[model samples]
Target: MELDVHKPTILVTGGAGYIGSNAAFLLSQQGYQVVIIDNFKHGQQFYPDWARVIKCDFSDQSILDQIFTHYNVEAVMHFAGLIEVGASVRDPKIFYEENVVKVLKLLNKMQEHGIDKFVFSSSAAVYGTPTKVPIVEEHPCNPINPYGNTKYAVECMLSDFSRAYGLNFVALRYFNAAGADVENGLGERHKPETHVIPLLLEAAQSGETFSIFGNDYQTPDGTCIRDYLHVKDLASAHYKALKFLDGNKSAVFNLGTGIGASVSELVNMVTKQTGLSINVEVKKRRSGDPDRLVADPSRASTLLGWKPEYSSLETIIADAWLFYQKPDAVLYYSDQSYQQSSVF
Candidate 1:
């Protein structure tokens, strides 16, 4: 797609991370110029050629000022934050600094630049333990861990910012962000690799025993259940959110498939997809893990005209497997910096 020079450019914070990178590519494909900023702490350095990559932390007001001055950014998709629940539990201070404090800096910059539209890359963790199976937006947010607390704090900030400064924002609370942009060669590449799908795939490939967390939950399989949404679908939702913001609307919606799959069920799907016997080892449940965390995405569908197309468990696993099988697949933390490359 040709660049629409007249359209306002979109700024993607943490555009090198899994979901941010995919969202940046999709936004560029739709002819919207994108400027990606990342501190390279947990984000991938590489991005699409059309995107203007600025290697800087969100907490740095000077660098953010430079980018805002250079580019005509009308909105921002905030995806730059720490996401490990275990790590957050261990070090709540770091999580609060990175997730909450840094975000305040970025929002201050956005306000200074008169950029009111914001799309937040929130997580389902904010909901903590869902009292109901199909969790809705109205559900009480009593996050059980520091990570969830940080996310909820940011959501509260967004609400206050909108009210005080007239900022139009949308917070999409994602369930399980799995899968990859197989066609574009982009997928999850966390250094520790805590997500279930990628961990199972790695175990199948390396013959390692994959831990099953715990089996004492009240679910059907006695394990946790999560709603998995594809990365591309997430990107699509972000795009639609930008369009939805044009009406001067500010809202919060859940990004999910409205379907639930257990941890064991996901392992079985991976086994079926790869034809490799996955070695499973049952372990005690980690702290702050909810028994079930599914989403009621009906409000998103009805309001933003958004629905996930790639919601199938089989499709999500197969796409991730394709990226994992690639011999030259890029690994996270391979180097300190990455060169600008175009996959399209």
Candidate 2:
């Protein structure tokens, strides 16, 4: 198979989804050719024009072989996987198949094609029920649920692959990924949206009562505290991880703001942003929820030179509100026009 060596190409596995789409756009802006493959199960039909979209599941080995045969894929940013913790708990089979088994197949194909660099979209869920606050990468990975187990399983697989096959990888274990690409008209649009930010926005806009599960946790406000990082910062970390892989090394980094915000604080932020008093109903805490899951992002900051630029509670809510208000806005790729102006 002939390869285009002039333009380095990145194959984004779930480039049509929320974080993946933004990563695709950022890669394109940084002058890398992007080829996106998504099943459209949880992703959207819209994407940047520069990216080549291939509608197929990552488990399809034949299709993957064809893609590797056609393009000179320099590296891969894998974001395609199931994320619902509750759903994973109910039916662990699908999570294993989609998240673990499919990813193994994709890695095998990458080995066949000699493409080694990988950036895995992992989760803070891997460090389930953290024994310490400001969780670090070395925290014991005792995932409390199947969704997190799948991610930890993949991280183990990546480690073995790197040791045996010389494949370099970076596993970014992210906390709550919130906010939207307001300039590009990209945001969270999950089928039954479960994220707190979007759910609160929906409740505020529609005057519906939103549920805050288990407010009597061991927190200052008796609510769960999570480290919310902006989607754009998460995307930038992917680009940085790709560059870091150029040194033929494997690493794990936590992606977050290192700041914890409780559920009550988030609700207050949304109310302030939208000027609508949101109604809330506190319920029993969901199973497998930790009281605090903030990140110690010093590793990512020191190594990748990446930090959360738009991760404040106020900015997160404001960006999400803009996207919620303009869901159908046209998305364009303009590097200079979309500069990070302070939203706070």
Candidate 3:
């Protein structure tokens, strides 16, 4: 399906970043007019033609006014924020300001504009080190790191807004988001990348020494275990959340495959899928590193009728390996008419 000129617009904040870009592309394919707001802080330059791109901070009041005024935005899918866990631990001020304070500004603008529907990009990190195997939505949130705390703070704000102002929203708390939308030319492009799969793929491709972080954890292989969900699957859930707000009150869901893969296992799988060897180096475990983190993901399935189609370990690695093989074709157009003016 293509974008219908008569269709209501969906404003996607941070829509040029990893998960947001994939979701934006999927929304475009589903015939929604996507208006993307991104600052391009990560140096991600791949902008698709399907969406109108606005190069600015999402919290910019002048730009927000223009966007809300120009487009008949039905809802907002916010994915723009600082996401590095280690960095968040290093300087918490930036994390809180970028992730929490800035988002408050955006929400204030949304409330002013009467655009009450929101689909937030939340994180499973909010559950911290889970007490059980698969974490459920009701899991107690005890975030050990600043990153997780920021996400939880946002969720709390959304909850408050929902109750006080009738702001319908869905906060999809995600496990690990991996893989690429190879068909749509979308892939992970984080600068100084920290994600496991991408780092492993780069190690395999370049024969670089990939540190295992720690091998003394309580898990089977002693490395940390995480639930890796495909980016495409995450994108679909965002769309589902958007549709869900059409009738339901505010809700939250965990998005994952309910499967766990250890770090060593992921390394081995990278070798298996890429047919290349990674120079392995074991190191001290980073502080706040958990033994395991997996999601029950039953609420999303039961509530939104959403399921993960490409979250299997095999499919995740396969798609990621394919994405690592080539350079991303820049889809940004130089024509001014194709870009949304950020100027007030």
Candidate 4:
């Protein structure tokens, strides 16, 4: 999948994180030079051999100036932010600060550097308690939590910026990003893991009881339903969105499979994959837990020429089980200094 021999260099924020790292590696594989900037707040230490990994916060104007000046950065892929929904509910101020305020700073710097092309990492949480099963791009955004509100805020900001400042960007609202890039040894790694697939796999290995959150939802299994897409597919969508910006077009798309899986069903899949009995504990539903949230990803497919290849639930569980089984898998956190290039 070689692209232009001298494809434009892309600045990937939070590139050491799960999805961002996968996208950066793929971009470098496809011949697009990559420059990654991360604060390493919760990002992984698994730096790839391809990217010019810089350990700096994307919001730092001085460091961003160095990056934009040193490299011929043609676009920015913003992925750094506080993503924990539960935490966001507890403290909305930090979520707004990290996700919205810091991002605006980065966008301002990019605008100053004359870099108008952008790709945003959005969330499906924006469509709060969807009225329709397969949520579309045009669905009303009534986010029920602070995390979703932050993502929606950024989306609105991008829209206004595009209209006022000639900025071209794509906002990809992702559902549950699961699975692993097993080939690259890159999987989910959160400080306090909140995602379902990894948590279920962890419990399967450690024999810990996995909490089901709630089994009283209105779904088939009496549990909340969500659309899960492989992290690999999510990464590829970012690449496609970057290429879509080459036409100077701005659009919003949903990155998800038009399929929903319940918590009980996912637990069953994990058990099936590992051949281990998963101890499940039902708990009270968290605030604003949507009954069903799938995606009508037709807009992304039609516009970006992208579709999921590794998002099937069976494949997702298999790959994730393999990843968690490895004893020496990469973990997050490293003591790296600012402006350091981690190209190996």
Candidate 5:
């Protein structure tokens, strides 16, 4: 299915998170009418100032009515939900309530309102430790934790709804979303930083020690390896998916760099880029992390024409370093900026 692409009204849910806000910026630049909804659990500022941003949860029907009435929301890009993997295990109910139940409610409201097109922000975590390497979109989903389970469940619901309600959707499964909008003005910032790239940047800024979770993986470097994709490329994928769904058909795609970098390998890259030494600490393995989680993004390439551009180890570390020094970058990440030497 293809779209007119001349103009479209896009309502972006969770448009305040790392990927959501970036995606919103790209949509606006592409001449799409953009509306954003966020709960601010992970505060995002500078929401493409051009976009109409609403500060509230979409699970609330009242706000939904207002948003629907205000914007000619022809399509929706769903990104609002809890994302902590470990925490999900402790509070599976919250994960279900927030990720699964809230989505169901949102979909119900969309159906009632006759809003059918949707683009979901799904995760590759649904694959867990795959039995095969370079896992494809067709790989069996055997989520090891509640976070992954919730995303998988949502995908299931989307499939169910597409058949039963004629709801057109494109569910994007993300492999590790890293880096930022290199040529644009958006970047990654998360409070209590958990993502690897940002944490490494923070440690370099503060001269603090960075932890390497379980350095005994089966890789050559003996540290966990993950497939890291630049967020800029990812946001593009969302926009393309939106157009794809608007064609009145349903599809799914994976956004990844098609390459994996080990934990030690990433540290080495950061060290090379910033010339800052980071102390490394190895801890026990995180419960749900697979030793390796690289993606086979061939399906997306053949389907959505999506590919990551800045995921090369050098550019990924450098973009994160630039955001570490910017103020707007602080809103999404922590407020503290690492001391800089005015020269990179």
Candidate 6:
């Protein structure tokens, strides 16, 4: 579907973290009037000026009311929530409140203001322990972890709200969100980073050893395999999802390259990209582990006309390396002369 081509006001929640900011930046470039809502807890480090950024916690309904009033928000691309899996297990309440309740709050505000077009950021975690390879949209959702469960729960809520209140929504279930925007404008910069691409990139740049979680999975590499989609591609999927939300079409689509890479395979990719040898120590596997999780994004392609461009591992690593040295992590480090990751 072609965009409206007329710049219209759109609200973006969690507009500071990796994907949201990139979306905002690209939206602005596409001539859309964008408004951002983000709590600075995780966004302070990488906030973007591509849109009118308004910092507020989504749990506060009062604040959402004020924001909708202030911005004349036409539509919303919701990305506000806690995202770490292990951390979600430790603190499920925050995830539930932020992902579920806050979503309802946002919808209430949207309904009150007579706004309804919503593009939600859901996750493949919802398809926890899939019954088959290349999980489809129809796969049974049994999210083993709190993070996945919360996402799945919110998807249900959105579907219900759409039925009950005429809420036009699109839920994009994304796979491993990796890579930085190549232009160094917007990229992943999670604090105490847990993401493999950014974490590996940081370790390589800082000259530190990255710990591998385990090395005894059923994959050929003896490590867990994951489909690593570049963050920019993820943002583009959001863009597609946003455009897909027309006058009367609510949908759900998976965003992925439909391929899996093991942890060691990723480390080797980084090594190959940087031409630098890295150290890794394998540890015990975590409890909620899926041997191989790859998504079949046929629906996204068929519905949203979305397909990943940076589907190669080398491109992901090379682009990420540029962002790390010049943009994303340059301010965080003390030493500037080092060209590669090693013990400083």
Who wins the TM-score comparison?
A: 3
TM-score per prediction, in order, is 0.93, 0.94, 0.95, 0.93, 0.91, 0.89
Global lDDT of each candidate: 0.87, 0.88, 0.88, 0.87, 0.80, 0.78
Q: Please provide the root mean square deviation of candidate 3 (C-alpha atoms, Å).
A: 2.1
* 1-344: candidate 6 lDDT, tens digit per residue: 11232447788888877788877777777778876667768865343444555556754576666656655566899887888888898899988887887787778878988988999899999998888989899999899999999999988988998899998899989898877776645666677688888788777777888888778888998899899898888878877777778756788888889988999888989988887778778889887788999999899988888889987888888888777766344232222231222211
Residue-wise lDDT of candidate 5 within 1-344, one digit each (tens)? 11232346787888878888888888988988786777677756543446666667867787777566655678888998988887898899989999999999999888888889999999998887799888888889999999999999999999999999999999999988888765565677777667899999888879899988798888888898888888888888988887777679998787777789999989988888889899888988876667888888898888777777778877877887876677764333322221121101
Better of 2 and 6 by TM-score: 2
lDDT of 2 by residue, 1-344 (tens): 12254578999998889999989889989999887778879867654566776777877787778777777789999999988888999999999999999999999999999999999999998998999988989889999999999999999999999999999999999899999989877788887688989999999999999999998899999999999999999999999999999989899999999999999999999999999999999999887788999999999999999988988888888999999998453464322211112101
Q: Superpose all Cα atoms of candidate 6 onto the true structure and report the RMSD in Å to 1 decimal.
A: 7.5
Better of 1 and 5 by TM-score: 1
Q: How far does residue 273 in candidate 6 sit from its true spot (Å)?
A: 1.4
| Candidate 6: Cα lDDT at 54 | 55
Off by over 4 Å in 3: 1-6, 332-344
lDDT score of residue 279 within candidate 5: 89
Q: Estimate candidate 5's RMSD in Å.
A: 7.2
Per-residue error for 96 in candidate 6, Å, reads 1.5
Taking the tens digit of each residue's C-alpha lDDT, what string does model 4 give over 12-96? 9998888898888888888889878887788765555566667777787888887777677889998889999989999999999
**Collision pairs in model 5:** 189-332, 189-333
Backbone clash tally for model 6? 3
The number of residue pairs in model 3 that clash at the backbone is: 0
Clashing pairs in model 3, backbone N/Cα/C closer than 3 A: none
